[model samples]
Target: MSILINIEDLLSGSIVEGTRMEFKKGWNPVPIMRSICAFANDFENEGSGYIIVGVDEVDGKPIRPFEGFNPTNLERVEKELVGYCNLIQPSYFPRLSLEAVDGKHVLVIWCPAGANRPYKVPDDVTAKHKSYNYRIRFRSNSIIPNDEQTTELIQLTAKIPFDDRVNTFASVTDLSKSLMREHLQETNSKLYEESEEMPLEELAEKMNLSQGAKEHLFPKNVGLLMFSRKSQEYFKGAVIELVEFPNGLENPYTEKQFEGTIQKQLIDVLAYIKTNVIKTKVIKYTDREKSDRFFNYPYDAIEEAIANAVFHRNYELQDPIEIRILPEAIEIISYNGADPSLKQTDFDKGRVRARRYRNRRIGEFLKELRLTEGRGTGIPTIVKSLADNGSPVPIFDANEPERLHFIVEIPIHPKFIEQGNNQVSDQVSDQVSDQVISIIKYCSSPKSRQEILNFLGLKNHSMNFKRNVQPLIEGGYIDYTIKENLKDRNQKYVATDFGKSVLIKIE
Candidate 1:
């Protein structure tokens, strides 16, 4: 089976971290088995790791002029690997691929987090007298877990992350071949080439997106979320709902819902926000060569906040990820907050880190799609983005104690806040001067245009109407009673709920 990631990216250490990858000059059965076992343990919940044989290493990185494996021994090595893997207590087998790097063959082992974990293997696979122990990856080395760590590992028995667990309700057909191909193509994976000809089950197996016995295959939760367009059917509230409260929640508001593959929804929602909400302002300075340029709310901060919400949210919840654009801040809310290990104090001090990710497989797909940087970078990225834009410090609330919900409230830039205040002041000033407030008050009960003109002591000319009542209608202070027939002789205007709120403010 082909590895889901680009082989070149793996070799260069561009996408995968050093701790998750190891380079071996040649295969030595015992050490390879230990590394494989450690990777299967996945001590940090950082997802599966890779082992590259036939590459010399120095300081934990691949060395150039690799000592490639002898191609003639490929069959014998495969047989040996299978034999050693059988020594694992639960009979775990990692995916292996053979590729040529710089005119020489190398063995790539993809050891995903095992289903039945806390796997143990004999110290020496060839020994008749064997000692078995559980091994885990620590940074770059495989080590036997201490008693405390061993107990923790044991607790994770048969406890695959929610995203990685096979969905008994979903079949392999639920995963879209097109979506899988698109993702493979986007990541530049070689799997994309073979995807067209491969059956759905085979392709899913190659991507590690399915599990169970060969006869009764089921798609994993991550697979459905990433590939199925109708993800909400399976995972309730697998959508984003964006609400804009331009005039406060008490008044009229606009809303939009984004649904699709999680990555697609993320992209669409971000684009919608950028075009509709994000505003750039320039302040010229006499003392400096460059003008001050910043956004109302930095795009980076918003992007990371929203992406993190999707990555960490509980898919089982009925609450959609929500983005509320209020006058002073944008609140990104999701259900079932941070991991239990993270305290409220951690969120308060911006030291948010996950001991175990709620959705490891989702995070992996997002990282591959370049939608997020996994491994606890989301909070810091947001903080830096806000700081750079001179926006107010973001509020991170993990709904302490129970952590029933998570909220990231990013304040609007101070300049934008000031500008909003000034605009309100200007609007009030304009209304007072134009005598439109009186017109609105007069129209509390729907009144004809003639009655309004007579009340305002204004002429009935088009310019007079445009200057007086038209502004009120356009400002949302009043609406036409006969809105569908604007030119109807019986058309009348009445105060809107928003207009009543405005009167409360100004009165």
Candidate 2:
């Protein structure tokens, strides 16, 4: 078992804090349920996260080591959590554990990435009374859900099996011997050498590629996909198209169509990306001495994104994988839609961290070739790399029903110098401000406090905003108006002329 992380380590930011402990004098199922959902959602959005329950906070800071909850009580709390999970739809339970720290029991709930892509709370009392929701935030204090988040959660709960599970009707002759030989070479030749004398049927069986009983297993489509030289011949949608555009999004400066086996196509595509994408870094200098500095787009992130597109793509969609490269960003779009098991908001929270390959055979083969690190680390790695590089977080948007798009924008670092008229910062900021302004403008009508929180990625900071929005209202930049349907007197905010003016100035 992973050691229970130290309280200080957790408090000092070693772990991503979701909801802090609210030590109410009495146990309340609603708050606990909300905390579990929030924390689990956070883990799903972020990866390998924690929900530290025990410590008390005052004014948003940990005030004292928890004087509440003893060991017996902690055990009772754990049992209650388990009961809560059992009641949830599809179940929102994590692998629950208890840690004793400074004589107080801290509940550490570890929510592993769902094998089913998305996990949802089943229709129980909690699900019925409370809305099915996920949370995210921009600043730090608000927690809110939007239509997009609700839709995403619902979509995630719907089951969509990996593409490889679909049986294809192709024969062993469809298998590419050359590709088989290459796979052998790439994976250290052990499997290839052992299977050399065996018949194709025997080989398929030995490799565990056959699905059902050996007698009924027809090595048609599976063989073609696994070993065929021209895999695209058997599966037309298996190819990847990599296009590098010039300065703008108009015509492509260079475009290459990669066909044949997935492995071969991936190798070729990555090589193409490395050659075409220009990477630059910033170097800092002292008053006298200069230091060597080098920075480039993270190879791991790019590779993972590409690998994910190829492996997780929905070949059944009959759309080709497309990689578009521009001066500012690289977009990888796969014809398949978002993982049915994960919500879009969960991506921002770093909540899930288990790899669920749409093509199990392809995933296994790629793992053997050392093309990808198994265990669902690809997305996290991509997010982390972008964060480290000082680039905006990559966006993963679902085009619905058909396509999953990933856009990675590589900004020119502020330190890099250009020839004439090098005002990249102003240009980029202006673009970002425009985007932010557009969102603000769209919410012009009086929205619920939740609506604004969702719009600004401030779901985690809802309470803070509840306290702060009044000041903005008092300042006359925004005003609160009551909702027509709701009985609550508390009003949501509408951007005032002043707010609009501020936006216009920035734009």
Instruction: Give me the overall lDDT of model 1.
Output: 0.82
lDDT of 2 at 349: 70
Candidate 2 lDDT over residue span 1-507, tens digit each: 122233454554423333322233334556555544544443223333344456565654554656445556766876777887765545765654455567666655554333333334432334546555443322233244467665654564534333334254655445555456445544443455555666666555444344456555644344565566756765787888877776677864777798866766787676545433534443444443544333345556788888877767766666788887766567787764656666666666755443333555455556555566555566788888767766566777655434454433444333333444432223222221222355457557777776666666654233325323433454455765664743465766688887778667665
Clashing pairs in 1: none
How big is the positional error of residue 85 in model 1, measured in Å on the Cα after superposition? 0.4
lDDT of 1 by residue, 24-136 (tens): 88888888899899989887778878899999988987887889888788789889989999999888899888876788878889899888898998888888898999999
Q: Which candidate is the best by lDDT?
A: 1
**Model 1 error, position 359 (Å):** 0.9
Candidate 2 shows a clash count of 38
- By summed lDDT, which 10 consecutive residues of candidate 2 come out lowest? 424-433
